[model samples]
Target: MSLFSRRKLSEYEPNDHQYQLNKLNFKVTKLEDRIDNLENDWECASQGESFQLANGIDAKEAANRVEKAAQKALPNELKKAFDEINSAVKNEQQSIRLWQYKLGIVNGEPQWVRIYHIAALSRELKKYGYETKLDSNDSDGRFSSLKVSWEGKETSDISKIDPAKKYILPLEDTECEITDSVTGKAISHEVAYACPRDDKWEIIYERKIYSDAVVVPGKNIISAPNWVKSIEPIEAD
Candidate 1:
């Protein structure tokens, strides 16, 4: 029989409880062995050798002498340490203006210009009924944002677009798992790609021809996974 009760697979329990118990048991066993060894060593030492005092000095008197020596030396040592600290702080403050200017190099105009260009592109895409999506690239690279056109055709004139009416780019659904592609050994996860050609949404190209990375030109098809029998669209708060 096991030392612990058999927990059913269906039973509700904290995930790491058993792993934590195993760790605690290992630590307790190690501590017990260390304490036993220490006690044995102390008993052997006490019986094996005798302690002797130099110059016939008693233990209490010797301790008192050591205390006095420390008291005499400690104050001078402390003052030297404090003087070194004060010197460092003084030097740092004297050169602080130069240090502060070096930090300003990171907030330069080139960085601002890069950000301004990306924002301008995002704003321009919004006028063409295309919302700007952040790319999958880690550094964002040369392409700062992706222009997504779901319905095709420009939603409004570039000059007439209201900033508030701008559509947000559709975020990729992470919860959807690539079932067939992962198991069957395919390059792409997406099953199909849809695009608008003549006012009608159609699956212009099938899978294996291209990956989701190849934009469908008009719309980025992010459909529900096969595992999901039904999905309810939720309103943002």
Candidate 2:
């Protein structure tokens, strides 16, 4: 017989059983509502948590400071390197270029590397004061290596930081567009590298989920533009 049939209802002489079924259904409905509320809360929290880092500052704020720092005369070999590279690009005909050169280790030692994403480098340097040490269209005019820091309050000390290090540009994490692994949807991820080894210029970018950031294992860094944002330096273990 059907559970809802009159015969089944009559089977419960005290009517207690039928009443309990109704109570159970009501409880199930309440539980479902609670589950839905929890799901919504989780979604919002997940979205917020993604942009946050182990560092206390907002990723956006750190990125802005980085970008602004790009405009300032950088410290260490940054300003000198930035100036030399920036100057050379202006004389080139292409919008994008990569420069390769060798330079000293404070006492005439040498290193070999190339600076890619030339146009992007030029753009960031434009935000700062323009000065290039490149005296000729040839490589000889370019310092090839950094010697001293630029003259200004904006200088960063190379004593603590290496001038060859890669850094993120002053870009918001939201500027990084990526396809979600789970949803297959495009979304913004926090990003912080801009220029190169010089400043917004170098590549030590903001921390994000491994999936959200691109990494190059075994390579020295230089800054570029949006197209080059995928390169995050991976530290050796």
Predicted model with the maximum TM-score: 2
Query: For residues 66-148, could you state the per-residue lDDT of candidate 1 as single tens digits?
Result: 65554333323222322332354455521100000111234553331222233333343344344455443435344343323
How many Å off is the CA of 223 in candidate 1? Answer: 99
Report clashes for each candidate as comma-separated counts: 0, 26
Which stretches in model 1 have alpha-carbon errors above 4 Å?
Answer: 1-17, 50-61, 64-237
Which regions of candidate 2 deviate over 4 angstroms? 1-98, 101-113, 132-174, 182-184, 193-204, 207-237
For residue 74, give model 1's deviation from the true position in Å: 17
- Give the CA lDDT, 0 to 100, for residue 94 in model 1: 18
Model 2 earns a TM-score of 0.24
Query: Candidate 2's residue-wise lDDT over 1-237, tens digit each?
Result: 775897777877668876898899999999999999778778879788443336669768888776654433223223344445445446542222224244536456566433322223444344343322321255543433222213342322222323444333233222344578999897755444433343344433444553323332122232233223222233322
TM-score of structure candidate 1: 0.18
Q: What is the C-alpha local distance difference test score of each model?
A: 0.36, 0.42
Best by lDDT: 2
Q: What's the C-alpha lDDT at position 151 in model 1?
A: 37
